[model samples]
Target: MGDGRSGGGGANRPAWLQQYDLVGKIGEGTYGLVFLARTSHRKCCIAIKKFKQSKEGDGVSPTAIREIMLLRETCHENVVKLVNVHINHVDMSLYLAFDYAEYDLYEIIRHHREKLSHSINQYTVKSLLWQLLNGLNYLHSNWIIHRDLKPSNILVMGDGEEHGVVKIADFGLARIYQAPLKPLYENGVVVTIWYRAPELLLGAKHYTSAVDMWAVGCIFAELLTLKPLFQGVEAKATPNPFQLDQLDKIFKVLGHPTPEKWPTLVNLPYWQNDQQHIQGHKYDSHGLHNFVTVPQKSPAYDLLSKMLEYDPRKRITAAQALEHEYFRMDPLPGRNALVPSQPGEKIVNYPARPVDTTADFEGTVAVQPSQPVSSGNAASGNIAAASVAPSRSMPRSMHVVGMQRMPNAGISGPSAAAETKRSKYGNAESWLSSTEEALLRKPNGGHTCLFEIA
Candidate 1:
């Protein structure tokens, strides 16, 4: 998907590669690299995530399979949509295509903190948080738990009908939590250190969606203060070592958890075993107000405190938080997070994401596009006009309200093997048929709009 000369010897390139024009590389992580591209016919921008081979070198990575399976079952405006899946029989490489998001919370926060030198508007912050919670509530209701919820994973659409809408991306570490065959702990450590919940730090064998809420709390604080609430150094020890520094950071600000505050404090694996580290630790519990400047009784402070509660059981749920006084206050949450909610409010123009044209799909140096794509934003740097068609509308009938669970949402049965059989791009129907049974399954279990003034 380049100007036709990028990814080394292209003598046997898959025909599906020609459907899109490769724009540049947008992101990279432990799983794989993400590339920006435009559909050849529709001219719509999309993000293609290329997964790395499993460590066993046998087939597609389990993370890729899990992401695809879970995404297929979910359909929400705030959730990232998996547009298509492609494979290169030559290398058995798997690529997942999704709608391209021009801005993410990480970049938006950075622009305000480092470049603009200002705090994010209250209206913007509330709208973004509301959307995030709405998306998360939907997942939790369906028995899905997002193990990781960081700023970078929260994406904002650009220049389209969905423009300014928040889309939660990255499902690599997500899981269906209802009656998991194995304990959730078997999955080992999850979440980034800074956003990790106290229960996770204390080595709780059994946890709930509260872990995700704690992360949302951290993200909310960062949105206001322009910095991580807990900036602790992570230990490099293996086999899921206890994060002493992270715990220490939390305790210093929130004060040490007591049996009175959290009745189950004594039951945690680390609470008693790591006594030497916990004993004699004196911290000022009143320091939360120091970092976050809202009034003690303000709805904002009240919601933040509940979210950062040391007791996971006491933590606020996404549905409850959506109705909190913080969101009901003036400048209520809106559909478009980027727009100003009140009249005479100055708009905060966020910079577009940076694209690196040097790397191709195979992680090799590639020739840049002959012409600069016309990206609507002038601040989008080098990238121009990467227009996209309107997002496909998901039927309202698919929407589930209240608490409903998916019975067989958990991954079961043997892993699907990446077939060595070479096939043409048009053979996707057959390829899907071969793997659909292994990947698709049913499970059991269980947002408002705001108008913006022009």
Candidate 2:
């Protein structure tokens, strides 16, 4: 831990303050910094996610809270594990400790691209895809939508044994879509621009996990081709109703969507208003056949086709895709993606993760290391719930994704005396020990990989 002391009087800190020794800054983001740490008692490795106050100088940011709650409740091998949480009484700062992972899909793809000697084999691809889908299926089945699903957000353990154990990290933009208290549309401008679904770009008020599925389809293509299939320049924010440039990029490769293909297509705000300007109708003749050249006629193509289906309702469900013929093919999916199929084949070597011991966490937010420009970025922003427009979908009394409480329920915060209240942990300041897992994961120098030190 650099300096170790975080603001306020040194000795007069919360009980949890002395529990761990901070190591070094692993990564930084808009909200805060993630540090590699170990517990004082057991010396178990942990990834501490520290969040500075929001602009108003309040408690934890709502986005951080959403992540804590989601990770705490979710228990899956493929999902990042949240070990414990703590709050600085003096500064009102928030911190979450999670199990550490080694590598991310972003780094993996970059490694393959930059390296001349090696490439990701097909068996590894099948394995990584299977694990990713497994985690995503868990999220969707729980009614939670991972609004941002890209290479960076998908983590892989560098433990060597669990080669295919991909942990879906970053829940800052994740929300439970079950019977939402506010219209799902209220959370506008979600998912990274590239992975964003066609329906969302068209300004569809009502959408579902299919949006996530669409992103997965994009990811699937990227893994196969070692590049983003639809690398559209993100349109600058505007008051207008459409993202014409992004839509055009998709149409140029996948062909224009017709009313016959997606029944509700014409009703969407962007498509209805700007149908005249949308170009590239002729590209539909070949569909995805022309775009994805490496993957030939197989069940993998079937799964990709279903995932990229224009009609979201018809998009392949996570469970269904897992059972696709693509997975059942000869090089059947494996548990260890990195393990070579042939016994004598070499185990791919990836670089070690860099640690910035000098990154000060005493004040301000940490910035992630910028990544090299590829076809486009993997992910960056998620503007859900920042919309200026009134929600168009019907509101209900149940839960809404990313919201602290039900709509109109009022502000949510813990009482100053909340320590005296009964909690899952004995006191408000508590610890839930995780295995403190640290695999050999690395981040590319070019990309800004953030969240729980994955």
Candidate 3:
């Protein structure tokens, strides 16, 4: 149980956090460093987000507590699952565990920009966009506003074919909406600057889920363009940093913003004093290789334009976005093919966190070894008894065939004798635990793999 805190070199994870067998650091942020950990009983890998205690704070920060509370209250397929929470009594610090994923959307996009077959396809764009919106829909419906919505926060489940099971993670910045507030008018401030909605920039004091929608719009634009649509370089190292060309790039391609399209411009807290405005420029294919098509108005582009509306009011609802013709055109393929390092992967990295493998009955350890089940003795008229040998499929590792289980076959099957479908905890004579049955059984047509934990 390397709770991550220990003799300090980096941040010391307290010994109380040692319940998890720590693997390696997956990520770090202002608050806590993330670790990959596994539980003893369950071999499930979970992402553990350990909240760092602020020297100034009297106790766990209210923000961390709020995040845990909100995450526990909301759940959705598009949203990352909050597995559990651990509070160290010794230090009174808190840790949140979540389902581990292979990578985030940012990584996937960076790696497969040109490699993605659906780079410019309306079908693929629509599907991914729809998933993003669906997750947003769930959050907004619960009255939750995910203040930060960036590609990095949206994670891709695996590197396999089911690559786009995007889960919205990182709710530390989220705030519950009570009423709409005035939009911020600072132009290039708040949240992630590029994805920040106009209202936040305008200094809107009171806001609603629309803020998140605006960020969603930015993400959609990025997925299609590969490059961030509204990103401008910040003035290096100055608190007075400003994005002189905040809307320059956005307007340069999409055209100038007008009171007509965005009538609320005058109402923004930081509206320009000058009435002068810019007009749309001719579209250039500067960074739009496989990410976008040559023609801007392709179905995907049209859909993107709708999502990225400057006016939060005009921004499409996640549900409505899902219904858009794009998702209806081509349903995303099944998950088995898309997830790269699925349960089958030998050693997969998970977010460091503690998860209850017993709750799901899928003891953490993945099925790699064949268990020996005793069939009635050959002399006991059990000659007809047969068992399915376990199979290991590895793209990089050599394939090994299952060996004939003779009477002399030792309890632990040798690696050389690979079994395709052998029962776990070998020994059919060994009683099956409820957990094993649930995890190892074929639910419907697919073999179910529970989330791994340490």
Candidate 4:
């Protein structure tokens, strides 16, 4: 069996960990490393997110606690399911096991652009958008707001009963906005800079679910064009400075926001401070059709326009967007985003996510064996032979660095040079743009741990 233990063998490992075999390391972020593992009984693949101990020598990190709290209450096919929670009693590290998703929108988009040298099929795009909206609608209906909505966070199931289903993952920045004890703004900046809402960029203390819709609009555009709609360089500063470049990118295509367009525009903290730099710029309001390839009169364009409306109050709700005529048009959205609704349409086979066998579950580098360890079976044996001591303290502030993927061999795009320049801001990172040092800086007594299965 795969060795999940530390310096000692499997006998020294916790009882809860012995139930599964670590296949390989799949992803690594600010909080911890994610491993692909197989349950001993069912032999089904699962993603285990192992969070480092709190910096204060405390127990679990607040981000992990918050994710468990929010995910336990939510049950939907479109949302990623939290399977189990395990604790390494020896080190007090937290591990969250989730249903493994084999594909994400980022990889899929890159595949189409770099490998296939074509656009994603219209049916697949519609299905993905519809499913994303459906999941966001459920979250909104329950008063939750997924502050970070991006291509990498949107996951697609691999070969299984739920194949091609979209699962919205990552709940680190999610919060319940309904009847908050304190303004949601107190927690600091939220959402990745590229997909941030206009009101958020303008420093609006009081915001609504419309912010999520705006992100959905950006994702919809990316689904169509296979690129970030607003790929602007993020400003790295304390207290979350206003992202002028990001806002400028949005305004160039959608036009500058005015008090007439957004009634509450004058009340925002930044706008109220007489920011002459914002008012000095003038942009054409009808430039969206130029950026996105959709027909001006098409229902798809209408839905996108409504989602990207300058005023949050005027923005279309997820429930309302689902009923829009775009979905009602020819070749309706299907249940499976990867499968074609009509027969005889070629199915696009997306490559599985890459796994790094050299990285151990303990977030330490290990030597690769002479013969590669098989990822398919549990008894193939563990690769973590050498144990590297992990740091007890982690940085208080965390920023999610984008997971790098290997491009298909011998396949290059025509705009590879342009893409390389944009990759610095667009693909190299998935920033949270937080104002405070800690991700969840609030006092922790209010949230109860709900998903501690182990």
Candidate 5:
């Protein structure tokens, strides 16, 4: 839409919908409906995404247009390939075609969660982690930021050796940072709450590809633990701009964000509010190091630390993460995610992910009007929060970048002058400490943090 749109017009090809036989609806969410279809001529399966038009007479949404533009330029094995596009002239329905993916990281993680005995092996974990980063590296290298990178959005091939190949799917939330037509945040919130980067959560206007790195950190943690690192309820956008509860959840683990630690912390629009919310929790790190139960004494912790660094600028880029000692150690990450079994180890044929042929997607937000949630379990309060329909939230990360994006300096973050104007926290010695170091340094009584570095 902003000079990047290749404009794949559907004027010439009429009756495009007739070409593929709709097998059944695969999925539906924020973007639109995904149908499993087979080409009439080739007989191979393909995914057809029917883009929803605005009900208020607005032609096609810019988000759909942006997706078409970004996917047109992005060509990588790790990224989903845009196969074909169709536009009905009369009703003006826009549809995008893609190769069908059999599994998403969410399904894989949930499968292991469901079956304790069928836990993913160590080599499989490393391979999936590596493939995820490899795809992410390709995206960041091209100056594009995948604003939304949760487990659900990362797809996996389901057959042969290619079955292990992970593909970065759904560009509806992805934006190119090539050359700027406007500031990144001008488009508003881009990422999902659980995987959102610290800078975005704190209302940083001009963010970098490090935002994607932060999400990668969360995904990496989920791969090891099978649960989100910082799973918190999203704050209502209109009533309150500040996400206190979410910030509280993060500080409970990562400790407080300060100027000494993150020079640009004070410059965030919501910094003072975050400071207030995270105040009493300082030095009260709620033993989160014990929660990230990954392999002990491995380089995995080091890589994760860099990825989840409080300062977005300090977070590991996808490229740097790939080269870290974690990937080099013990069971080196195999090219295929489905690693061969050892001599005596029994192979677990992890079942192919289930595809719901008749799942209803008409109602984006579903309320069990008859069935009420039990007040006894407070954890179930946020269950329906994630189901909110995706709307026209313009992402800040979409602006075009003229040059290659590089990691920022540790002191002042991605952009020094842009974020930190004056030092708010004057105590410089506190900079010597990190939250992870404090939590993993020793056990308070009998509980030891299993992720303690050697």
Candidate 6:
């Protein structure tokens, strides 16, 4: 097996990770670092999310805990699958192994914008929107609300094959809706600023899945137009109303929103006093600005508008949005139809997340997922993504320093090669060994145990 100390401050490096060959850095966020790495046993591609360590004796943040717990149970073709978690006792860090994918939607959009015209074919848009809704539907059905949904959070795997699927990747802000329960915290605003729903903008104490729908609306508009629907310069207000005549701009083209048309307009807690503003009027700018900025709207516009409804209660549900006429007008084709088989690799199967270990690893101090630190959605919960400690509970955000695929020759033994083979084939058994299992059982020498089979 490959083993070596990486980076300065060797004290922070995990003992076991030395064996895996570091390929390169894939991404970086506030919480921790993500690296594309290959183990000695398999040539399989795996994305390792390393969490940062806190002084809390290898503990992870809370947000990571919810993400892990939910991912462990919710597996679907539309959602990214978290394969396995590794924790090392010596350095107190955690590593989450996920199935590697080709690229993210953000990159694809950016690439297409440069090579092709700003315009995108309707077929591609249809496929993407359908996949997005399907993933959202699955999440909502399980009573899990993905508080933060955006283009970047959607992941695409495989190459130009119809079977290549799009999966929703992040669950850092997801939560189960339960009445009469302890609030995670007061005023938790979880979606990205641009994709954030208006109700959330108004600081609504209790929100629902509609917030996600708003993000879908924003994404749809951006995809159709190749630009964010509500892109605007940040203003100084805490409630974060758009600086320009954004609302008016949307109304003139899509049609005006009057008290009679949208009766709930008067009810929003933070509804602006129009007369007090510069316009001193209702939608004087133009509604068609949205349509004018973009090309002609396909049949999809009708459905997209509903998801972007001003009233949270009136907004479409993920399930309802999936069944909307826009999607029904053009259904998603089978995987084989969209992307044909490539030369070397076989098609990826849906629901590819590795099964949770059933062994009794109660005493073992496996790493735990962490929680976002800030109250609203933007702050990554307490868990840093890059780490590998037995006591770590969550993945901490790490700086995505850099990544490279390790060569086959780097592996030393047949046993190691076999392990790598298992990983490539998605075999769960290869994740840990009998000795590792014994170590897991004793995660912490003594103290109340937190790591349990999900």
Judging by lDDT against the true structure, name the best candidate.
1
> Please, what is the whole-model Cα lDDT of each candidate in the order they appear?
0.74, 0.64, 0.52, 0.72, 0.63, 0.53
Off by over 4 Å in 1: 6-11, 367-454
Worst 10 residues of 4 by lDDT: 391-400
Which window of 10 residues has the lowest lDDT sum in candidate 3? 397-406
Residue-wise lDDT of candidate 5 within 41-76, one digit each (tens)? 776667778777555545455676667666765667
lDDT of 6 at 220: 81
**If scored against the real structure, what TM-score would every candidate get?**
0.82, 0.75, 0.64, 0.80, 0.73, 0.66
Best of the candidates, TM-score: 1
lDDT of 3 by residue, 1-454 (tens): 4432321222244333445565445566767766555654566556778787545425455567667656655656678888767554344456788877655656545544654433433333454566677678766655567887887888755432333366789987775543232232322234677776665554554456777877877777776667677776655554422343555555555555567888876665445532343222333434332344435655556666677677778877765665565544433422221222234433322221222222111113322222211111223222221111224232221111231212212324322122311233232112223433332343332322123222
Worst 10 residues of 1 by lDDT: 445-454
Select the stronger candidate by lDDT from 3 and 5: 5
- Give the alpha carbon lDDT tens digit for every residue of 316-432 in model 1: 998899778787677777667776566556666565566777787776787663334334534444444233323423211212234232232342321211121112212323444
Distance from true location, Cα of 34 in model 4, Å = 1.7
Superposed model 5: Cα runs more than 4 Å off: 1-14, 179-181, 237-241, 273-275, 279-283, 295-297, 359-454
RMSD of each: 9.8, 14.3, 18.1, 14.4, 17.9, 15.7
True-structure Cα RMSD, model 6: 15.7
What does candidate 4's lDDT look like per residue over 1-454, in tens digits? 3364422246655566777777677777767878877788887888888887666656556677667667776777888999887655455567889998878888889888899888898878888898898888777766678999999889987655676789999887886555423466876888888899989888888788899999999999998888888898888874763788898899988988889878899888777664676877677765789989799999999999999999999999987988888887766776567765565566666766666766666655556532222223223444221111122121121111231212322225324422432443231112222311233343442222224543
* Preferred candidate (lDDT higher): 2 or 5: 2
State the local distance difference test value for candidate 6: 0.53
Candidate no. 3 TM-score:
0.64
* Backbone clash tally (model 5): 8
